[model samples]
Every structure is written in C-alpha cells, then in structure tokens.
Target: MFFMFIYYFLFSWNLAGVFGVDSVKSVSVTEGESVRLNSDLTEIQRDDEMTWKFNNIMIAKLKDSKSRFYEDNAEGRFRDRLKLNDQTGSLIITNTSTTDSGEYTVIGTSTDSTLNIFRLTVYANLSVPVISRDCSSSSSSSNCSLLCSAVNVGDVTLSWYKGNSLLSSISESNISISLSLPLEVEYQDKNSYSCVINNPIRNQITHLNITQLCHMCPDCFHCGSTEAVIRLALSVLVGVAAVAVMVYDIRSRSFQQKREQTSPSNNE
Candidate 1:
C-alpha cells in the first residue's frame, strides 16, 4: 500500500504540467432549465485532449477530435443529459435539477495543460405567495394580522408590502425553502397590502385588499339572529289578526240572511 501511494504521488506530479486550471467560477440557473459550462476554448487542436469531470470523477473525454461519455462515470441524475461539443470542449446539461448543483472541472492538454472550474447552483423557481387575514378579535378592525406564505422555493426572498412602503422580508438558501411572514396593521377602506416572492430569475406576488377582507366578517351582514327572530314574530301576529277579522265578517252576514228569511212568513 505504501509503494502504491508513492507511485500515484509521482504520477500526479508528472501530469501536473497538463492540468493547470485551479480557479473556481460560479453559475446559477433555475431548475428545469439548461446551463452551459464553457471551457473558454474556441477550438481544440489536433493533438489536444480534453476531459470533463464532476467532483473529480471523469464523465467525458475528447480524443483525436472525437467526443466520448463514460456512462459508468456519470451521476444518475446527469446521465443521458450531458452533451459535449467536440470542437470547443464545452458541456451542456439539459433540464437541470437541484441535485445537479456541484463543481465541474474541465482539463485540456495540448502544448500545456489548462484547467477550468465551475461551481453550478440550481435553484427551484419561487412559488406564489398566499395572503390571509386574521380578524378574530372583534373589538376593532385596526388590530388585524396578515400572513404571507410561500412553499417549495429556493434561493429566494419573501416580502410584504403596504402600497409603496415595505413591511417585512425573509430570505432562504435551501433548495426547498418554505416560510411565512406576518404583518399587523389596522384595517381601513382604502388600505392596500401585497406579498412578493422573488428570486434572481423569477418573481411571484399576491395582493390583499383590506376592505374586501373586512366585508367577509360576520357582522358585515348588518343583522343578527335576534333581529331576524323579532321580524318573523311580527309577521306572524299580523297574519293571525287578519284571519280573525275575516271570520267575524262571515258570521255577521250569515246571521242577517237567516233573520230576513224568517220575517218573510209574517207577510204571508
């Protein structure tokens, strides 16, 4: 084992002249998109050899003007999605996902070895914000609380706004960040509030109209159960009184008819 380590150490030092790139570059892209990791080489020479690796694992190679990809070396998430250009030695990854984020290195060998490093970051798109109001305390409308929430977002920020003024903001770096922020404000007819979710590549928002939310309150119907019951009782009494008056009028007419018929016999 000691002899093997020494052999590898000597071999790496000898190849050091061919792989000279050590600088790191950062690139960010939204999920489900495409990104190109450029080699910064316009063309490859006839004697030049190029290799692309992910985290030091060789995934692709260019030899004698031909491009080759080793399926066993590619990560499962990147398999079948990696494309290499034979001329320039750049790599294109299609339909990238969060798991595809990592460091990629390209080594080119011709007269001298050149190395290019890329740190790729894949972020999921920001989700739309959902805004809701809590008005449980009926004492006053000025103490209502508004909540703004977003889920399954990445490299993004969530913020609250009242017209042109800012209320609160939160940011996260996780690939699937989820959070909520609350704003307490007085409800008014002309009050306007909004929630914003945004990243470098995309933006989402939701609006809250205070007047509309207030109209959803129970008291907004303008009447309670007691008032409805009183009105119903008055209608019933009016209906009963009309029925009694009609019965009395019918009885008086019947009695008058009978009295007239009996008096006619006296004339005979």
Candidate 2:
C-alpha cells in the first residue's frame, strides 16, 4: 500500500507538470506597493472555474460562475487587501508588505487543466545612509574613523567601498531596525570612499572625502606648522633683499654725483 501511494503521488506530480504549471514566475515589488498576479487567461467562460492559493492555502475560489473569496480565507494579513477578477481569475494585492512575499498559484478547472505559479518578492525601500566621523581616538595620527548608519529597514546590506573596491559589508535578515558599519582610513588618502545601504530592490550611497576633513587638523595635514614657517621665512628674506638693493643703489648714486661735481668736466 505504501508503494501504491508513492506511485500515485508521483503520477499526480508528473500530471501537474504536464499541465504547464511547473515553471515558477518571478515578481518583485517594493513594500507598500501594489502587485497583480496574472492568470494568463484572457477570459473565463461561463462553465470555467478557478481557484487561487498562497502556499497551497486557498484564498480565492470561483464557483457557479461567480468570483469570491473562499470561506474563512478573508482574514488575517489578507483581509481587505485581496481583489479578484471573475472574468480572468487574476488576483491583485494592494498595499503589499514584506510578509506578503510568497508563492501564489492559480489553478483553472476547465476542458484542460491550467496552472499558473508566481513567486513574489517584496522588498523594503532603502533609506539614506548617515555618515559621521568618530574623533574619539587619542592618537595624534589623523586617521578618520567613519560610521555609517540607517534605521527602520529590513533585509539590507551596509557596505563601505573605496571607489569600486569593496572594503567591508554587513548584512541583516528579516530585521527592520537600526544598524551601523564603520571604516577607518588615513587622513591623506585621496581616494573616493562611500557608504552604501542597499536591499534587493534599491540602494543609497554617501560619499566621503578624507582630505577635506584633514585640512582642519594640524597634526594630520600639518596645517599651521611647516607651511606657515616656510611662508614667513620667504616673506622676510624677500623684504630684506628689497631693502638692501634700495640702500646700495642710493649710496652708489650719491657717490657718483659727488665725484662728477668735484671732477673738471670737458665742457667746463
């Protein structure tokens, strides 16, 4: 009897595949959006009947040429959110949430068995990542420690990148809360770095410029020490050289005038 039951199950499975219901359709949408699962049927004849299920739990049924929700199916997460079309057996879900992501199947009972399957993936919208510098280090080295964070998100990954090269990444699963990631880089590094927050559907990035931040730190860029001394020395040397040249020119001119006055001129 067990062998017979196995054979029956295999035959039923194969029969389901023969009806073109084996291929799974993929659908992706953002959270709080609406999605429609197409039945691939343009019209349902008067004698046709259809049924829709989510994970094999019937949510909609068509009988006696009338479309309606199955008894006790319009409750919980699906309450007031499911719309069914009687003519085509298509199902539309409104204000979709991440919990609504699942496999939906529509079965048609007519002259030929029809099966349509859809795997729906709903993603939360990515939030803008906030980047902040951590200046708590006691060392004199001006290395910048940056923290990137986002809140109230789910199924996301936070990453740090130097240009196109990925440095670090953190991923969260099924969580809708706050998280953060950090990166430390040298003060003089001119490469472009960015913090990215992403989900399956969207991503947001914030760019960082370490050189700009280092301009204010004396220890990092040597802001006011070396360069300022060099500038001051150059200015003093330039001023002294100008004064000496002026004094030498004046003395030479005065001596020449006196010699010309004392010497007998050819015309005199």
Candidate 3:
C-alpha cells in the first residue's frame, strides 16, 4: 500500500490535472436545463484565487472571504438568479431562456501557475414547470397523486408552492381528516393535492396533482370532455353546410331552365 501510494504520488493523474483541464471538458445545456460541475477549490492558493469571468468580464472571486461569495460582477440580468453553491462547485441558473445563454469560464490559478480553465454554456427558461393537474395512479387510494418531480433533490420537506409562494406547511407528519373538521368545505375542494419539496440550503418547488376517485368507471362523476363536444358540433355543422350547398345548386339550375323556357330560348 505504501509503495502504491508513493507511485501514485509520483506519477498520478492528480499531478497531471494541475496543468490540464481538471474540470468539465464540454457540456450542452438545454434552453432551460441544468449543467452540473463538480470541482475542488482547495488547490487554489490564497493569492491565486480563481475568478469567474463571463464573456471577458470578471464576475466573482472564489473563496476569498465568507461574505465575498462569487465575484460580485455577475451581469445585471442575472442578479438574483445566478446561484453559486460553494459546497459542490455547482452553478445554477433558474428560468433559463435564450438570451441568458452564453459561454462562461472559470479561471483558477495556483501559487504561480494557472491550473486549468473550464468553460460552460448557460441557458434560461422564461416559464417554470407548470403545475398542471395530473391524475395518475398511486399506491395510495388517493388517486390524488402528484408526479414528475425534480430528481436529486436533497433532504427537504414536501409541500405546495404556488408561483414562488409557500401554500402549505412543509411537514405533513400529522395531517388528519376529522368528522367535525368542516366536511362540507373539504368535499368542495377535495380533488387537488399539491406536492412540495424543499431544503434550507436550496430552493423549494411544488408540483400539483389531482382529485379523488377519477377511476369509478363513469358512475355519474363525469369530467366534461370539451374536445369531444367540440368535434361533435363541428361534424354537425359540416353536414349542414353540405346539405345547404346541394339544395342551393339544384334550385339555381332549375330556376335557370324555367327562365330560358319562359324567354322562348328553349322552345326550338
């Protein structure tokens, strides 16, 4: 073990990475997706701290001070949206769109050497994930299920969030339905349950799902089918138009023959 350690120390990729690209090679980011970056900042020296530059402009300084998070020069548009997670060397931008997309670089320096430079592309999304009412099946009898949640969320409570607002309590430890607890009101709004999850260190989000017993096989709880009705109406209108055109053509031809006969043009 000791010889292997010595061999690794003398001729290992660790030493080689100090001169080459130790981080991301190339990454593709969708218009509003994430690009994960995992790296170590400890190799940086005190005087040789890294600086994040966007399009040739300095945005932030790395690990210089507790309060001195990221270079303070982040572009005006990205003020509150650019999240620099120091723990994981992760960079996150929310609500990605096309204009926010660009080339970003991390320039790290050592005692006297520039270790490596990593580059990434960023994108923006104007719209967030819509909390549509999904009525999928779940193991719980409450077909009132929510799904398509964000993956890799750390330890966080699940609850409802509406348009950047917390709609309910994070902890659902003792939620109970009681007989005296306004059963009428509950019946009126019993169809939807919002699923929320959040952690203190990171952002929280809520996705909505829907109503009870959507599966009772049509025992009179009929969810309206707007599309089917529209199609039916359209079909009837087309049929009426066809009949009207046929009648109009026949009447016009008959009227023309009668007029010719009366004018003596058809007598010969």
Candidate 4:
C-alpha cells in the first residue's frame, strides 16, 4: 500500500509538470491600435524567467530585471513592434496590423513553470458603404435598380435592409476584396431602405434615399444613358422645327390678307 501511494503521487506530479498552471485569454484589437497580453502575474520574482513566443517562436524575454525583445522574428513581421514589461512580464504590441494576428504563448519558470496563452485577432478599419444606381438593372419605368458597395473589406457581411427587415445579404471570409449587392424597388415606394457592412467588431451603414435614387424616369436624366441622350436631342430638334413652321404660317397669312384688302374688287 505504501509503494502504491508513492507511485500515484509521482504520476500526479508528472502530470502537473507536463501541463502547468495554464491560463488562456483571447484578445481583439483594431488595426493601428495597441494590445497588451497580460501575464496574470502580480510581479516578477528575482529568480523568475519569463519568455514570450509568437506561434512558438521566441519574441521576447524577461529575466533578472532585464527585458529583451526579438523584433526580427516571424520573418520580420513583428519588427519594431514588441514590448515586454519587466515588472509583470506582460507583452505589448504597438501599432498592430492585421498581419500580427495569431497565437501567443508566455512561459515563466522558476522552481516550477506557469503558462499563459493568448489568441490575438486584429481587424482592419471598416470603410463606409457606397450607394449607387444600377442603371443596367433598371428593368422598367416603375422600378429602380440600386447597388451598395464596399472596397478592401475582409471577413465581412454586406446586407440590404428594408424597414428593419432583411432583404438580402452576402458574406466573404479571409480575402480582402470589393463587394456589391443589388436591390430593386419601386419608384413611388415610400419604405425605408439601408445598406450595411459589418464585421465581428463594428459596422458601417448608409441610408437609401428613395426620391433621390429611384427616379420616376428611371435613369433617364440621372444616369446619362445613351438612349436618353438621343431622345433629348430629338425632342429639342422637334421643338425647333415646330417653332419655325408656326412663324412661316403666320407671316404667309398676314401677307394674303393685305393683298386681298389692296385688290380692285375690294376697292370698288
């Protein structure tokens, strides 16, 4: 019984050594901002050695009241961006960008080891959504075609909403690219419509102006369509010709009346 207790104690101690007191944390920050990964330590001891790693590659270290930063690691992705706290052994990344997103691990050792893991996610600042008329999609005079667009967005959803109701939505992941969504509405409709672009962190919105966007003529004068331009030109020409014909007719009638009044039969 005494030998069995000794074996059990040894197994438990081995397990503890293998998996030390681990604390995991998740952090998110926008691009061009700073984020700090806490070490959960009140203070660094005299004999404690703390090391910070990015995806298992050493980036920083704190030992004996001195802090060292390896800013050239990870293919120079973290160049000049790492800061280590000598007192608490925390890691601070300044002016972060989307490329600086990944797993971070901090290991501290003295008599025993303690581990703190952090998953960092950095997001780019969102751009305002753009609203425009979709001229090609204007199928009829009563209906108007519209398009909402955003550029250089990643892991975002572009959606069209009508009076708090969802109409259509599209999403993209990982790749940064331009996105556009189309909506069709009636020219005389009086409902509120809006376009939204959102990510996990924040959202951008643009309200739709029905009167300004959905014209009664449906891109006749707004979109500068070739057919509309030709029609305008023909209308101008017709008005000019009608005015010329009217002037000629009025002059001819006046001359005929004067001749009739000056005739000998009229004088007798």
Off by over 4 Å in 4: 1-24, 111-114, 174-176, 216-245, 266-268
Candidate 3, residues 71-116, lDDT tens digits: the string is 3454465565556555433455565544554555565544433333
lDDT of 4 by residue, 101-156 (tens): 99998888674354678889998898999998886663454677899999755888
lDDT for each candidate structure: 0.76, 0.78, 0.45, 0.84
| Each candidate structure's count of clashing pairs | 2, 0, 11, 0
Residue 132, model 3: lDDT of 34
Q: Compared with the true structure, what per-residue lDDT tens digits does model 1 show for residues 114-209?
A: 468899988786677887654443323235566788894667888898787888899887755577887766655466778998887678889887
lDDT tens digits, residues 175-248, model 2?
75687887777767778989898887788988887766434444443433355556768999999999999999
Weakest 10 consecutive residues, lDDT, candidate 3?
Answer: 177-186
Segments in model 2 whose C-alpha atoms lie over 4 Å from true places: 1-19, 63-66, 70-74, 111-114, 137-140, 174-177, 209-268
Most accurate candidate by lDDT: 4
TM-score of each: 0.67, 0.65, 0.32, 0.79
Better of 2 and 4 by lDDT: 4
Better of 1 and 4 by TM-score: 4
The local distance difference test score of model 3 is 0.45
